[model samples]
Target: MKQFKVIGVAALALLLSATMAFAIGAGVGRDGTIVGTKGKAKTVQELIDMYDSTGCIDCHEDAHDDWAASPHARSIYGTGRAAATMITAMKNGFMSWEYSGVKSTKDIKVEHWMGCMKCHLPQLADATDEVAVELADTLNEWYANAKKALKNPDDKKAIAIRDKHQKTLTSLNINCLVCHNRMAITHKWTDGYPQHDTVYGFNDGEHEDETFTKMKRSLIMDESIFCGQCHGMGPNLELENPTQCATAYGSYMWAYRAEGGQESCQECHMEKSGLGHKILSYSDETMQKMAIDFKVESYVSQWLDGSTLKPKAVVKVKMVNRSGHSIPDG
Candidate 1:
């Protein structure tokens, strides 16, 4: 009887230990993440402030500068084109669709904008529906003012309005927190959720930052899958209305990895290319040179046709994509 009781206690202890382990690894029960702690941002500026990484510049000046030069900095307002496209998608796509639930900019919700913002500004997920509507209206105003400014060229009011909205749109981007914290862990249940006060990187230790005082190691920080989360495969079916963007990661997996190519996105775009935080594509001259190899051969030959000899010019061109994925990928 005593032996049976001992066995029962031992089994109970083991079960409790397993349960505790699972709880710790379950990632704060969903509402304990940084975004959750902060709650949903109500405005565009509030959302920008929620994921602000301006303080990072004090310690990581070089990385900040490099990142500022990258498209990630102005992700939503990419050379003024991205903002226009966002508005176009809202106006043409959401408004035109019968069941999108968005008939106008005011009707826009967080889910409606997720198709674009999912990559451009993942932080948008932490914002309220009102923020989404505000962002849409702001982009529309920016587009209209920009057009007026282009026509007049000297209308300071139009130019000022355009610039003001541009600044707001550009403020919300894939900043340090978005990468090193929010998106640092893909398998949250396995690796544990990214803590609000922890900055994930190559090592786990004490950090000097005020807000993010602890540094934790991210398993996928240097992996291609880290970038793949946003770069994507094909159409994003998760949303009610799917939106297809860049398939570079898809091509990289099937075309490159399937064929035994072993390079990661960071290996080519960051390390070997020496672009570092300024992760560029074909836009930068260095990336352009690294992505492709071209060769041309031309010769003049004499041909005999019946009794007459004719001169013929022949040109041979060869090109190869040396990058990991397709040449013209988004």
Candidate 2:
């Protein structure tokens, strides 16, 4: 009993010490974490805790595990380089963004979570449930309330809650719900994303959605409009061919836009023939070696040869998986 009591006391002391150490936004991580605001948000560990606390773990426990092992999670968390730089900027007065001269590698200290859609969670717009309507109405109400507060800055009662709501930002991120959920393809005539699933298999026509009265969607896989939302190479998710690039989905089609193969962004980017959500970071080495064993396409006989005569035609069939993903290279 004496030893047990002593152990309990020791544990209690340690717990209290940790609790006391926490400041605003401070939390733990698999490695070092920064805490506090973007300026005061010190350590990389605290940022990781913020990311983990976004409630993504509840749905994507497995993908999160894989993410922890990926180079992305490591680079973001392990390298305190960005965190240190953010601190420097904070001291200089640029509070949130840790500006870096380096283009690709530069990331905000906690700049990601400023929005809800960045995380791979499903967009509420895609919801078929009344929950989206409820949430939207709530946000609208809150927005109105906050707007009123802005008018009367002196009102303390309305300021606090409205301030939190007004400043409520999420880390730009994604979870497996994004990758696993259905996605639409791009089109020249419409916006991308929230597009209809065309080339992507599963629901060839419709998309998988929950029952809802009114909900906004992120990757709505219903029509060409949705895929164009992101696969867009043009302004405002409007579909257009980027001059230097091939197809928006990384296809060899810029040169052949007139061809029927002038496919949309989701045609190549979204899952089809073993494509994953990570998008194409495939090296020639990965895209070079065939991963899949067999071809997964069907050819229409009517389109194959003239129907009039059974003329034996020499057909050159080459099925190459050029995209950096797992495809059955037959």
Using TM-score as the measure, which candidate wins? 1
lDDT by residue for model 2 over 1-330, one digit each (tens)?
Answer: 999999999999999767655532232321121112122213223322333433445544664665544323422112334323223333333223344221222322222211222222223222222332233333344455656677988877676765443332122123322332233222312533222222232333443333111223333453334533333322222112112211232222332243454444345443342333333333323323432233454433433354564434344455654433223210
Stretches > 4 Å off in candidate 1: 1-29, 301-312
**Superposed model 2: Cα runs more than 4 Å off:** 1-54, 65-257, 262-270, 273-275, 284-330
Clashing pairs for model 1 are none
The TM-score values for the models, in the order shown, are 0.88, 0.28
On residues 1-330, what C-alpha lDDT tens digit does candidate 1 reach at each position? 999999999999999967765643444545557865777799999999988999999999999999999999999999998888888888888888998877677888899888898999888988889999999889989999999999999999999999999899889899999999999999987888888898999998999988889999999999999999998898999998898887889989989999999999999899888999999998888888888888999999999999999999999999999888886877
Candidate 1 has an lDDT of 0.89
